[model samples]
Target chain A: MIADLLTTVLVLAGLAFFAAGTLGLLRFPDVYTRLHALTKADNLGLGLVVLGLMLQAEGPAMIFKLALIWVLVLAAGATAAHMVAQRTWTHGEFERRE
Target chain B: MNLLLVAAAGFLLLTILFGLIRVLRGPGSGDRMLTAQLFGTSGVGILLLLGFALDQPALVDVALVFALLAVVAAVAFVRQHGLPEPAGTPMHENPVEEQPHDPPHNPPEDTHDR
Candidate 1:
């Protein structure tokens, strides 16, 4: 019962973060700031979701797999964020359309 | 629990839908690419929720693949699109530029007479 409750709470929180991240992406002024919002919020959201799922995993192996997925995403998201930021820094901000 | 998971997944889907507006109205390609990243992360969340809610472990593997592929897509975007840097700007502000090397340490000039 406790496990299920925890899962519900964690998953809901994760979804909230996802919503915020998307909102930032759509509304933020520029690419660099949007990258800040998207990369950080989304990854943390995914991590929370993974943690919630881990509680309900079938076995040790399943738990490990979920953890692995989260770790891979964390690493990949960081690298991709850096690359995008560097590209934007060098190339300059894209002109905004009125 | 199952219903909750399913509902959460649906919510994530909604977020992804909202992200699409950014893609369509992108003032820059980078903005579009960021939406793709949003899709990838949200897609993983949905797959995982569905995997547990529906009792299909195989869906977890699919989520794993989704995570991997998102990075690949980002890499491809960076490689394929080479936006022109602003005019008259230095190519890069590398750290090497911060240090001034002694003239003696520089490569020796060729001294052979013609």
Candidate 2:
């Protein structure tokens, strides 16, 4: 029962972050800030979800697999965020800001 | 527990759908591409949740693929479009600094007519 409760909390928290990230993406003023939303909030969202799922995961292999997915996402999300931010910077998207 | 997982999956899908707004109404290509990247990550989350909820471990592999391939798309976009001008030195400020062949010039009269 405790395991299920923990899982539910983690999952809900993760989903909330995802929702916040999406909302930020919609409402943010520019590409750079939007990148902030995607990188930070969404990444955390995925991490928590993975953790929640890991609790109920059956085998060692399944747990490892779930963890691997989170790690892969962390690496990929950070790299992509950097690249996009760099592109936006170089393109002078927000250069005019004082 | 299963129902909670299912609900989580549904919420994630809803977020992905919300992200589509940026993709659809892009003021810039970078924004569109970034939004797509967001989709990729959220999609992975949804897949994992669904996998556990439905008792199918195979879906994890699909999530892995989504995570891996997401980077490829962004890299391709950066390669093709190229980076924007570097910060700190506005191009207008130094027209002849790099391009000697072309002289420092102002916009055409018609362009400034507005």
Per model, kept true contacts as a fraction are 0.67, 0.81
Cα lDDT tens digits for candidate 2, B21-99: 8888888888888888888988899899899889888999999889778899898898667653334434436544445
Cα error, residue B53 of model 2, in Å, equals 1.0
Question: What would the TM-scores of all predictions be?
Answer: 0.83, 0.82
Best by DockQ: 1
Q: For residues B32-103, what per-residue lDDT tens digits would candidate 1 score against the true structure?
A: 887888788899999999999999999999999988777898888776576443333353354543466654
Candidate 1 C-alpha lDDT tens digits along A1-98? 99999998899888878988998897788888789889755578998999999999999999988988888788778877887777777677765643
Task: Give the residue spans of candidate 1 off by over 4 A.
Answer: B83-114
C-alpha-based local distance difference test score of model 1: 0.82
